[model samples]
Target: MLTRAEDGLENLWDSRRAAGMSEPEKLLCRSNLLGSDKRITNYGGGNTSAKVMETDPLTGAQVEVLWVKGSGGDVGSIRMDGFATLYMDKLRALKGVYRGPEHEDEMVGYLPHCTFNLNPRAASIDTPLHAYVPHRHVDHMHPDAIIAIAASRDSRALTAEIFGDEIGWLPWKRPGYELGLWLEQFCRDNPEAKGVVLESHGLFTWADDAGDCYALTLDVINRAMAWFGQKTHGTEAFGGPVRTSLEPRARAAVAARLMPAIRGFVSGGQHMVGHFTDAPEVLEFVNARDMARLAALGTSCPDHFLRTKIRPLVVDFDPAAPDVDAVLGGLKASVEAYRDDYAAYYGRCRRAVSPPMRDPNAVVYLVPGVGMITFARDKATARISGEFYVNAINVMRGADAVSEYRGLPEQEAFDIEYWLLEEAKLQRMPKPKSLAGRVALVTGGAGGIGAATAERLLREGACVVLADIDGDAVAEVGKGLAAGHSADVVRTVTMDVTDEDAVAAAFDRAAVAFGGIDILVSNAGIASSAPVEETTLAMWNRNMDILSTGYFIASREAFRLLQRQGMGGAVVFVGSKNALAASPNAAAYCTAKASELHLARCLALEGAEKGIRVNVVNPDAVLRGSRIWSGEWLDQRASTYGTDKEGLEEMYRNRSMLKRSVFPEDIAEAIYFLASDLSAKSTGNIINVDAGNKDAFTR
Candidate 1:
């Protein structure tokens, strides 16, 4: 049975209000409450609204306003500003001149003009639908149980049987002003009805109060689930579990061989990242006897058209395939065939007014025995698309278990695939970053320099693997990055860089996670300070193990993976300014850095043949968050400078030509430039991120 979060509704509202919740905040809370439950909505799906009273600037009087969730705001963590307040009367007046269908653009344009507040947030495309409803509160969500019935061939009859006359049904209509008007009129006619179901779209439940509306929505969904359970006699979705002969290691090996081939075919010269998954559920579903036929029907809902397209590409696989090359060839052929079929489908149903055709590549590629591959311009988008397919697979199985699986016709699918609103949103997005489809690995990722570099790479649209000996700290760092991007973009692995076995395992995990790596940041190191006479053997070994030998191990693994993939890549070693400008008590420290710098140059000379570029970033005195500048080291540096800790920090900042303190982020930016294609032709070079320390300049 599906879980419902109706407990403590009144208490939650009271607590939120006492904590100073505005109308929008309350609405956001409700939206998040619904969105938090995956069964109710997935990713950015679903929207909510509340009728609020706001001051009219012109008349200085209170006015009724509709505060609704805005586009691109995930309902789970929506903020107060996430809502766009619109004048209800102005939106209602728009229906008089509504020119039937093909008004998606016109309607979208009109909604913004009707905003009560001068703030120009784009309300959801379903704003008109919410405005037309008479209730003080309204919600629309795509719940799995409800959609399973709605997407079935018998949706209308089944819905009627379940709800009787408590709810009304609207035939599938493209969301526009006209449909909103029809929904308003339908609600007026059926005043006794609790809500309405948009056939093959979603559910709308409303009440004068927010809590009641939410409760009603849950009650209705619970009824649907109960009915489905009785009909299916409690059989689990996908029938029975099907075990795979290949274990995890073998599955990853197959994925490693097939990922590049699939990416090569789908990318068509443009960059694309491929993500593989062999979760227990995925393995069972893909291995089912009739997997291909079942998945070929269509997406679980029209909302998925932009992401997963109408259907997934199901690649035929034989577990007994003789070699990796054979499997790769099969994967390549399947992708090419999918592209051809997609072109044909588009040709048959495209409208003259349709937007330019998107790349004819399938977002989802399913390998029956191995697993599934999801592709997109970036790792985050690829993972989101993959998640949608996972949910759809479940819904499809449920629909089959209860009734027959049916989806929208080809023309209907084309309509949503080319929807104007979706296109407009895409146009407004910033262009993909230079490293959009690339994957990066950073050592010392739990600390200052490594974490900052990882964040910079994430912003540039590269999937990152953060490796550090601090396992828990790196996990927390990964969590923070995941919040801003997709979880697939940042992976954390705990490793002592000196361990060859650990380094190999981390690289292997990264390859399986994001197909392969494109950039390597060898930033992991320890700092030691002592005169040649006072330097201890233990201190010397520690510095060399983590600094010189550690860098060699990580760089070698990176080279191995890039060689295996036969793709050109970049590697940046994080050497120190001390490598060039030695300080009097830094014997072991300076020697290890100097050696590492040359190591990078050596790799560059050899790697150039295979299209790999190697470089070094030398940073000086980045002490704010540096894990290296602490404990007795701080006191020793202060004493050497004839001052306290704070004065010594100031002395270092003034010593630089820029007369400013260098930050870890400064180093990250330099690393980013070298890691990206912007430095494609430049290698065997050193970039200084030391706020202009003249003594450290290579020239």
Candidate 2:
């Protein structure tokens, strides 16, 4: 449901293996981006940057430069170490620039340092845009589900209804200097705004802290995508030319017919246009299709005048009409008329006056059965615009195969064409959920952590299964749950995470008992601390058997079943803050817990292809009474705190910035957020429910 930039940017931001970043702090900063939303990006679709003071390599003096995520890194996995150094002045100077769309030779020549010299990485197309961000870090991504819905015909209206004042929708533009300039001014005007949702494009969010950038960007996209998903008609097939090419002669021919339609659509029965593009995806698609039909969708965005001219030469070529020159003559005439109408429309409606009003902003070419053609200044803009018109055409196609395709009544399209209404409807919102039919499976379901989570999920009305190694405990809780109000209700199953057979059997039981599991909580864990020198193999095995191996068992089983059904589900591991921060005499316990975090992170990606979400819940110092916190351990813990039972319990309540230690219930709520309908797009994030306990540095 979410469309991401090609997986080229996967692993850009993340907590672990930020192996190539130049600093340690960025690693800590980047990890905070993962969450239960699809707003910023789904899986890995965007990139980020930090402007740090560094000595210029050539100048040998202290100067400012950007350390941005390398092109291929995943933002979710990105760390300060993954950043590539580039001169800031060089990047900001890219504005007012122009070049060949494909090579972008002039722009590329302007910044030689953007290339990393090793590992064959190119700066992201949004490099100029990132340079424009005033913050220390900048993030950008195509949140699939969100942008996909935002690009549709009714996007402005729908987004208006959902988010009244938090969004800023910019018309699509090629990703580069111009867009950066536009955004820089936008961010300045609305300094407090969370993000800018580029129409027919993606999202942009930034902050001084990498975590803030990651979290805000992700949260916004999730909310937008969720809003769109409900109203969108997700048909299995929405056809468009899988291809298009601008052979010189072919281009001229398509322009003839498309020009008239476009003019009529733009004006009051008004104008037409020609188009061009150099994006790899658009070029790839264009070169593969019949020129005529490919021209119809035109280019990425309607305003992409550079690659795609504003109305093309449209000639309906067929064997029956053999006069080629006459066709060409017809095409030129149509392009002329289209151009004239555009001038009149611009004169009447556009707020500012500019010369060359006759210059068409897009181009289209048509061939009989082959469909239509459109073009733009570059491939990116062309693709965005093409998709918009294509959706409109598809909607109008009706049962007649021969679509009398038209733009939303010409008047409406014209008003929206330059509507400043984007701002009137933009509004930031605290997150909201609309899930009703979703389901979930929480491991450690019968116990404290899992029980707390199950209760929260149940309140959300999800049909759930209480799974645990303690069969009696699971049964006891399962029976106590009220089933009358919930859908398909609750199922209790005994599962041993370390037992592959039992894990498989348990999932199957969940499937039969409640239809199919939708969310999974791998909360079942055994925590025991011991110094590395004194730790016994038996203790190590115990931790591994239950924490690490048991976790894999649950996740692996869930993935297999979830994949079989072709729908998606979410999984959350109850990881401890001890995994990220250091603690003395807890090596074995730490190692097991740390492994669970990585397990979820890696699986977050692996499960992405199947729509199953995977993330971790890292809670700090929860003093819940579990097996490890037995009477003796509790007494020992209480003694260390210099307090009685109540005082010992109160210590964590004021541990961090929030003056609170993580409660089993608090972690459970966070898990519910990740596993439910609200977090449909989130995966691979290590959610810190530690109330700021592991603030990395002593800041």
Candidate 3:
């Protein structure tokens, strides 16, 4: 493990500095690898930089440039532009700080001009410190293993005992101008201090040669692990009698508790992918002893606190027990105290703008063996915290043996935890609901899938104008939906998505209906499966015209309307998973879907400049009861599955890992989530409804 870790670190570090590497490509690659695992860094947690030689425009000489990670990028998914370039000489020049008139303002102007794009990206507030690192390839990470050891009792003593004098440990320091000065001098003083361990926080390693820098990180993790393992022994803190299962009743109860917040957050427009796990780890944390002892005990490496808040809600054992209410009440009360404390800490250290309100997402369970629980806007952060908790608990056990785990000082941890610059780094893709309060002219509203998607958006507070080629039939369908909600909530339009004039009329009617356009769900058309050779031109155009073009015309009008409104909107082309995973007789059907897919992407980028959000939903096989299944179709599916009607229904749907079929409502729910603020920062993203078919989909 040590060797593998060391090798990976070395390769990543040295690859950037390698002569063969393209600078922009190396910057993005570095960010991608560092962003992949929370064990390495939390959400937007780490920064990577490369010192490259560039020509001075006026001086006509070679100079060093520092391309550091940019703000608003998730390292896991940053692109080439995510690296902001700074003139190394300018950064170095700033080191000679003098209180003068043009000092700060001059710095800001130079800061932007130094970028690869002349555009300004928020610089890491720690720019001075990163710029000053002697190494060309420098990385900073808040690794769990290191932090666990750092937080333990006797951490400083244990660190000294483990590393001898080669390691330099710094007391927690405020991480901006002063910290930058301290780090520069410390590196100067301890020329042999291979790695710097910031007490209670993280580690910093650099390499004049990137490979050496990366190697030291692994070496540090290994050393920290060894010290931690020796510190805690024979305590089966994580391993236990094993939880047979979570309370089945608890699922519904917890779901109930989580629902309101989810609903309020989504505001009833988008459906939440919720239902929590009392997974063994979650249960273990909940039932552990001394849970909720202090909120900090189980926090996700401090950085995560920026998004999911700082601590989780630690429910008690026998969570259903009435007494649990009293405990929960206390937890809520503690929230104010935590918020007040964090805000106060911000005020004490902050010299600039105020920070966002403080709240924690991690909570320790009171049960001796119970673990912790965390919540996130999406499944990703929750999973990050879960992994962090597992590794942390191990570190905690280790610390118990070596000495108590020492963590960052509360305020310093809070500063990093609530660091506004870091928090603001998350690139929030504009959520697509810019169409909310708008009218959409869906081409195939009478159809199951189109109707389902329309329902999803209507629930999102958008006014929908349901249109279909089968005008009369769709009018009736829209009438039915309107009755269920409000007649005005849905207006029926009789226009074929395939007909140009009709498509225009429908848009006109929508504009008349809703007074403006906000969101668009362009789902309309038919599909006929046939072999490529057997497919006729006529068959291809029929499907392409009625389905893909109909969607196009509707989308085209929606795009125009969205443009006129001067606000962004989300327009989801109902694409099929067949586009990615081909089927036997889907050649022509496939091409049209592929065309719409590309169209959505092109528009996503183009509309991005317009504040418009565009994306496509490629749902796998959808077998819902709306309009897709006529009596004959149902009978055929039932007979093919060798089951009775009910069994065939379940068989058709319950084949996914989640053991559920792709329902029209499910598609609607997923689309609603994507169209709302939940996916505000998620333009150009495709969501697959396929449940774990390895060939199924992509993120």
Best candidate, TM-score-wise? 1
Global CA lDDT computed for model 2 = 0.57
Q: Estimate the lDDT of model 1.
A: 0.81
Each candidate's clash count: 1, 116, 52
Model 3 gets an lDDT of 0.60
The reply for model 2, stretches above 4 Å from the true place, is 1-433, 483-488, 625-628, 631-647, 695-699
Distance from true location, Cα of 309 in model 2, Å: 54
Sequence-dependent TM-score of model 2 = 0.38
lDDT of each: 0.81, 0.57, 0.60
| Cα RMSD of predicted structure 3 | 17.2
Per-residue lDDT tens digits for candidate 1, residues 229-258, read 678885655656453547778888777667
Per-residue error for 250 in candidate 1, Å, reads 5.4
Query: Mind giving the per-residue lDDT tens digits that candidate 2 earns over 65-94?
Result: 776665445566665555566767657555
